[model samples]
Target: MRHAVTLLCLLVLAACARVPGPFEHDPSRDYYARPRTDKAEVAISPPRNMPPQMGQRVAATLAMELQSYGIVATVAPADAPIQVDGVMSTRDADLSIEVQVDWRVVGRPRTDEPATVKTRARPEDYAEQSERLISRMAQQAAPRVATLVGKPPNFIPRAPGQVAAGITIPYEFPSDPAADGTAAAAAAAAATGTTPTTAPVPTKPAEQQIKVLVAPVTGAPSDGNRQLYSGMRRALGSSKIVIVDGAGEDVFTVVGAVNLTPIDDRTGKLVVKWVLKDPAGKIVGDIEQSNPVPLAAARGSWAGFGDIVASAASEGVLELLEKAINRPR
Candidate 1:
């Protein structure tokens, strides 16, 4: 079975070498369409165990980060259903600070677990980088908070016959010329009133494995491109799908692009698009994620932010690959 699968993959690679082109939408296909959930509104309470000014800064940054995920967030005191409270502590020796936040939806059962975020700053730059540190902490906490309060992202459902016992590739192979020739020879013998030669029959059909190549993310801020790329690779690796480092052995390729458009002076809309293509360079489909983000939160290094975005988008990318593999021959 292993040797048969290997031979099948080699045959696929040798059959096509076309590069992919720009995205073209197919209105007829609804593979990427999923029902959107209603947006949630959240209010951030003042931080405890910190100076009033610093606490307010933390609250404000947290609000901004939540807003980026399409949640209506505010630091001002409000009558929102979801309330978030943060308790903070700083260690002077290491110049590190940790913030533990509890998210509660009014009238709902609350758990003891609080989402914790921590960041460290250089001693020499501590005073000057206070805002940066706060931003980092907020970025880390936003995803957790959003998950608790905001509506969850759409999940792609697995197609029929997809849940096999092991790693089964869903690809369909091309017609075998030898099989066709055998049938033709049998027909000729029958017409001539002669006995036909026996042909060997396989007990099971050969299986072909599919490999995907993930390209570097483009148009992201700071080191976001590399960060997103690494995050995507990690996400794909955790799944049943096989990921290839080089394009030479891949059956499909994935490319990501980021676009940031300013909504106002303080906030911007961040759009991340993941495009999947076959070996022939035809666009299989695309997954897009967009939200309003504070300019301050996205202006600097996207250290942790990239991973968060990539993790969320990988689900849809895998779905696209599945569709391609299971597509009719």
Candidate 2:
């Protein structure tokens, strides 16, 4: 099965590279013809502007795949934690067909990213080849959608900290209602004439501190970018993020790019892009941020620009780190 899936992915890529021009969309085919399992419901939103038949087929294909994994999938289920929607458009690039999909969690607009797939095939076979690639891409994305929706309610991701120092999260599990139900029930019965007692909720701890490496900032002039490194260190350090000089086992690396434009003699706009990566070099996520600057304060030296941009970067990183720590695994 794994080999078949791998081959399907490779074939889809190869076919997309050859297909050219507008692909035909057939609306009569049934993509979900296999037996399905009964499970938790997932809503699949019909992709907007796509050919009706092709869109429905893709949605059905996703729903069928999800059902196999113990998730009940439907077209627009009334209540679901997440829904899948996609938009397909073709462009002339190396005479190949490209399909892009963007999936997100319901009510969480920030988790949007594109998943693209391609196929290489003759122009005469573009329609069949395109559908094949779309179906394959839908299949590939189903597992990820299911996993995201299946995350535990109390899931807490590992704190974003230094690779060398690692993170330490101090937490106490809340009392389980099932375990204390009998006692609580008896207490409630006895206290019917009075107020019933309740368990105290556990308090969450402060952010975990770890070693962080703030790489020298880039994308600005050398003369004005001088104090960026130190400024970033100070800004992030004040937010419970300790800066380190070198990489280590638990060290987190912060890389930044800034674009500063002079709006006027007294005003400037700074756009800072930040990327956070672990010691092993896997990207945690972007911590990029932007803020307008007062040229009067940020004009005299590169340090002035560093002060404003680094502070914004610091705030952005803190926000993303907190979200990562609290996000479901």
Candidate 3:
């Protein structure tokens, strides 16, 4: 009798922990999660509970798998051919659902199987199974996705971090080197016509007036880093990258601590550290931006600590811009 009671209690707990099953999301109503493609022109919001990578790994694997099946497809934020959206859930089975994939160019409706698959397992076993099944199903649907894209199915399995890797944090006041004192001097000379001094101009235009989010985790935001945040915001905004109303929309949420500890000077990069968080305050990206700051770096040199910080931060910031630009719409 005691044994029977224990079994009942266990079953009750198991039932209480049930997750949603397949077909749970209503794509007809847009009540679904989306794909994670670094190539997406805009980042769709992630579901409330899952990590960013969870969606990315699954999306990439799914896209690759769908491609194998000859479906005409592309990842979401795709203004391309067909946009394949995904919905994931688990219960008696682990299910990664396409919910519904929309086509920018309509295709022949299916008289055949709907896009779905399910693998039954314990709660702990669901995540892996769901990923694999989603991948397999996506592979099965590639032909359709390809067709929707009006191409011979060219689907690239984007590696994880490709999106995040593109996010960068800059550390320069005059992100546009053209805005430096030399440029100022040139402008002054051009205005005053005082023996017009000649200063070589940099050909590459810097991103300006692009309002960026600075989530610093370093010991302190170096002067260069602060300048970068200020300058890049200005440059990107003025660079015609966004509409006036859309200015400051591009944001990178930093997370983690930027370790500034250098084992040695000169050989040691300035101690820099930080990470990024999503708008919901979830951390998705991290990095340490520091290069060897020579002891002599104190003596103003061309490659001083300030210069190095700006360079490192600029690299990080540029990456962020790339990610922002590429995120799915």
Candidate 4:
């Protein structure tokens, strides 16, 4: 009788847990089933509740996997062809964690159903399993994505210096340094039928403003970091940028990773890599800025480090502004 009672309890516990399964689909919505143009790029958002570094690793891994199939991909910030977002949930069972990631294409009527992974709750296990699952998904999805956004549209050949409107060549960053800066200039000039003499000079450019949320700096001395954070806020505010609590339409987020390496007893080099992402989780721009600082000043005991961060913030904001100008509409 006792054995029977224990079995009943175990059954009840198992019933209480929510088992993982494939994503649900609405049959009426066949948007994803329909053929479409190939996306030029893909941006993957990190899974929630994971360490930032780990999440980035997953995205980067997925990006590489997609690239192998001839698709351009990155962890979010710059405007891209598609966006990927995901969530992770835990259940009472030891191996009941579930993760799902969805792919969204701009102007598309339907989003691709999410690919998911279910595994034991161990953090390390989750990471490894999720990586494999994501890699597999990327490989499976790439051929379809490539086919959809298949070919560059046909256009009449023009003179060497001639420009054409409504025509674009999909470009990815960090591939060619010179081309990276030219994508925007080329877009702006495409409307005017004139070859850009230099990187685009915005004529009558609108006051470019975006709402931004700045995440706390990592790997910096706390006391000095607070001062630097405040100084950065002030500098960005003066540039006519509005700081926001969350992402929304016309909103962006700024995140950073900082490393302070001591060069001597008192002086050190602070390396800051800042990334800016638009509301869709597209990377807009990034800046890797470094400055020398005195240890005392870096700990907020002196103002020297604050000044340096303030200047760096201004420059970072300027880069975002340029990205905004060049970003696809």
Candidate 5:
């Protein structure tokens, strides 16, 4: 009876066992996605109230030291979102040169406390020891500056089939007096039954065109300012908008500002803001383009790349112009 019971128990266990085939996965969970740990980027402006060469060295050293803490830092202008500005001063007393640097972070809702670093060197050794002092100051200020920034927000790709509505501006061609004179001569010939030397000019109603003057771009590195300026003109030329050389009573002005922030040694974030103004200098609207680009591309010549950027941004620019045109003056 005990053997019979044992056999029955074994049969019951076998029946309860699950057959293994393939492991089931939840479709809702991403199996291949990794956690994002991207850190914020910081910009270090050249130190003020100091010699130009020394200021440059200090800024460069500070950037390098900040990178040691896993922070991507670059020497850039004041337009960057997280900027570190330093005012340096030197004092000579008792045959010794004392160097002091006050570092401040500029940002919204600023929470970082300003840091100051000071070092002294003998008058004879000031030149040779300046570098060491600068490096030391950088090391001390980097940690405090690092606390001022955090992980940057993730970038989301735009959806497909996204496009702005087309805007039309009213344009009238300038009257041509020479063409008018030719027409008069032709008409006289026709009436007097004599052949005219020049052919008659055909007259038609003035067609629509919008004249826009693209101002030189600001805050771009290398030759990017000029490249973007010409590129914007080229992009606008394709539409009904006429690119003008200068601002006039009938012309609209487009001003651009480019801010490049290094995200890493290899990559950077470029933000281009285009502001449109009417002939009277009244603000129309602004369009912005932000994207991640290679650091080399951002810092180096924009050359062929500027055209691509302008083309991508032209649509929004045109849309803004359209809105301004439709708006009641």
Candidate 6:
């Protein structure tokens, strides 16, 4: 009897097995299928009165795949999640069951970036394709969540003797504030009482070797161009940036140029072509890359050139260092 029942089940499957060929939508031939996902926690909701079987199957597979990729999904009883029904459409040809199942993955967006889940595919392509789609969706979504919640702590970076703007900072200048003051009153007071007047030495400005010659930048704005390197160092939490003056023992040098490029007919951004040259002026490293910056909507400003240059320089140096350190021996 069990053998007969097994034979009957086989016959049923054989009958249902479509002879692969071009199959069109047949409203009269439509049949309701069962939910594919059998797991109790995943809630699979299908489009209303259409057919839940195909959708349920698709949804279950999707939920399972999402779960595999670290998303939480569950299969539960009917009347579960009441999301809008997704439309399932199909076009079939010999050896193919081209099914488009449009449904939402079980949760919110990646990066908290909202996305409306719409999926289409060949259902006959084995369960892997659907699961693969779910995997991809979840993979994409995870980063967005991480980004929204994983921002690093705020750090108040300060220069070697510099203080942040709003707070009182302990300044560590020379101990002799009385006579070292550049003001005329302090100078005259020292000179008044035979106060062993020795010309006070001027403390040197803090210097970090730029170790590079990025630009002579001889166009409309020169000093502004130089400020790019200066500003970048500040942003990178490094005061070690020094402007090259041709007399540093650090023989390694990175020379570069920033060009303005047209993003579209009306706008442009900066690009840098950098060369790393040894003391003998032989180029060791050469490359070209773009630097993206936020442009102010104001019609004429370089349109926010100051912030762009600073950001560009910071990124370029950071890239150079990362490459330099990570290069295989």
TM-scores of the models, in the given order? Answer: 0.39, 0.32, 0.25, 0.34, 0.38, 0.28
lDDT of 4 by residue, 1-329 (tens): 00000122212222433311111122322335543323437776666765676566656654543442334567775577566655655554433343333333445555543444432333444556433333333333333333344422122212110011111111111244456567767887898888887744334434444566666656765334443444454455435465543467767777766677898886666666667777778777677665565443344321233434444555656677666758688
Candidates in descending TM-score order: 1, 5, 4, 2, 6, 3
TM-score of 4: 0.34
For every candidate structure, what is the RMSD over all alpha carbons to the true structure, in angstroms? 22.0, 25.0, 25.6, 26.3, 25.7, 30.4
- Lowest lDDT sum, 10 consecutive residues, model 1, at 1-10
lDDT of every predicted structure (CA atoms)? 0.57, 0.51, 0.35, 0.47, 0.59, 0.36
For residues 1-329, write the lDDT of model 2, one tens digit per residue.
00000112212322452322111112221125433323336788766666676677667656644542345677774465456565556555444444445555566566454333232333433465343333344445554565556632121111121111111112123455555775676687787866555655444464465667778667754333434654565566545565555688878788877686887764556565778776788777775454455433333334233444466557667766666556686
Question: Which tens-of-lDDT digit does each residue in 66-172 have in candidate 6?
Answer: 32222234433444332222444555533444343333334445344322332233343334433333322222222222122232112222232112211212212
Model 2, residue 84: C-alpha shift (Å): 62
TM-score of candidate 6 to 2 decimals: 0.28
Better of 1 and 4 by lDDT: 1
Query: Can you write out model 1's per-residue Cα lDDT over 6-84, one digit (the tens) per residue?
Result: 1222123223342111111223222235232233368887667766876777677667555434466788587666777
Clashing pairs in 1: 19-281, 20-281
**Candidate 1, residue 249: how far the Cα is off, in Å:** 6.2
Residue-wise lDDT of candidate 5 within 79-168, one digit each (tens)?
455877877788875455766666777655446555666655555545753433454455445555655455321111121100100111
- Winner on TM-score (1 vs 6): 1
Ranking 4 against 5 by TM-score, winner: 5
lDDT of 3 by residue, 175-290 (tens): 45655757688788879988656667675664443334443223332223332332222223222222121113344444323233444643233444444444445444444543
Instruction: Tell me, by lDDT, which candidate is best.
Output: 5
What lDDT does model 6 reach? 0.36
- lDDT of model 3 at position 175: 44
| Candidate 4 residue runs with Cα over 4 Å from true position | 1-209, 264-266, 300-304
Over 4 Å off, model 1: 1-208
Better of 1 and 2 by lDDT: 1
